[model samples]
Target: MLPALVERYDYDPYGATYIAYRVPSTYDDASQTRDPNLLTDPAAWQPCESSRFGNPLLWTAQRYDPAVRLYHFLFRTYSPTLGRWMQRDPAGYVDGVSLYTYVASSPTCHVDPLGLTYIISPYQIEALIAELRRRPDIGGGLRGRTRTPSDQKAPTNGCSSPFGDAPSGVNFRGACDEHDRCYQTLGKSRFECDNEFYADMAHLCLAYASSEWQLAECLRWAMVYYIAVRVFGGWADLYDFLKWNGHARRNVSPLEPSRPAPRSQPPYTQPPYTGLGAGTPWCPSRRSPYGD
Candidate 1:
């Protein structure tokens, strides 16, 4: 029985493939029997100049035409021999001034699969990741990769309180309700939603307070809530995505916050000079508002 020969392939940094195979002459005719033991030996295997596979392709994504020795990309043709694209980029000078550059001329580090844009993974969402890792019970089952952040759904209860369930504690459920809606709304960022949540809590803490001490305590509790959410909040998964194509969208326009113009002061009117009159000075005792 003859041992099956498997072709071995080697690749260079620039998507070039080298193959090792056997000569056809050894098994050319029925009477010409080759040594099976030779096939198993490493010395028997040699580099093949010609490829048996009709379609030769490149690694950073390309369809190779063996006849022309050129790779057919989506928007450009690449010549592995020249180590550059044969045509200009279809997206014009968006990437850079050089139109024929491939992966910014760095094949080993980057890959331009579609011949349009170079892809690089940016590790972001630190807050979200930290929260997921810190609180396993809450974020354990929520780490879903099947859906994007834009597909997040609002909770049926509106505000599933992350704060203490004790009835006497601050009613942060109202803030959470607003936050949940803000998250579900389109074009709202996670940062924006979280900011609004903090604002709502602040309003609640200050609005109904009767005394200065009460106000201070309420603000303290509000700050605690804000800090908790700020540190251990849910990941960016609970918000709408600003851009999709796997790249973070950059806003080209300036984002000047909306602020009303300053109110103009009226001209001061000088009162007529009044005559001074002498009188005995009287003093009143100051009263303590705190009943001290």
Candidate 2:
């Protein structure tokens, strides 16, 4: 009364190399025991070992260039025989070693997922934010002043704060209007939108950040606050004013923490990833710890 289901996989003698896989099928009748066309054929088997794409046995080998006989790894292209990359790292001399080295020529110890920058863990994020809060340019008391349209003519580098001594044309009223527009468009509270904007700016700043908190400070003073003062003229002062009065302090813990709390379990955990920016790891349904 129930349909019969069958699945099969064939591999090499060592059992480590995959050979072929048969599509699962359901049969209902007793006479359907054998399908002559289902015989295992060597030529019909998919090439799992040398193929360009999916190779169950070789998880690290992403792509194959048959012409060059090189396999593409995440951060670099690797030559199997040479045990090195064919070219130097595009990220330049990030680690101050040989540019051609793959994972510092230590494959067993390191993995580069995006071929770009190293991944920032949650702990690192906390450390960076803490350092940012200590900076005088960041957590220092706000400058209580306003700007007018006449003050907007100063040239700006498009990256630093437009307020204070280096006055820009950004007026306070325009800043308010822009903030409201961003809040309405994003469908978030003004504070929430500011937090999201900070996150985005922080992500961008990471590319240029050399140390902890540098990225956060860069985002705060160089990008977000800079743009605000550049466009709204004096809105930067008003925003700081609001911040000083605690009206704009919601969700700004990184920028200003009232007091340090006693240590407990870490608030964040690192997600499983092969390397920086590598994203989620792939595991077969049957082998997954969470179940199929």
Candidate with maximal TM-score: 1
- Tens-digit lDDT string for candidate 2 (1-292): 4343232333222112233433334223333645545344333334433433344233242455545656565446666557656777665554335666554444433344434322222343344344334432331111221111112333333322334311211112232333334334422232222322332333334433444454434444534353343223335553664467352364233323112212441222212111111111120001111110
Against the true structure, candidate 2 reaches a TM-score of 0.26
CA lDDT of each candidate? 0.45, 0.35
List runs of model 1 lying over 4 Å from the truth. Answer: 1-5, 23-42, 121-292
lDDT by residue (tens digit), candidate 1, 44-127: 466864456543554444566656767776557778778888988766654456788776565654456556544321121223
Q: Which regions of candidate 2 fall more than 4 Å away from where they truly are?
A: 1-49, 52-58, 73-76, 117-292
Clashing pairs in 2: 128-213, 152-169, 169-233, 170-232, 170-233, 170-234, 171-232, 171-233, 171-234
Error of 1 at 117 (Å): 1.9
Predictions: Cα RMSD each = 26.2, 21.2
Q: Pick by lDDT: which candidate is best? A: 1
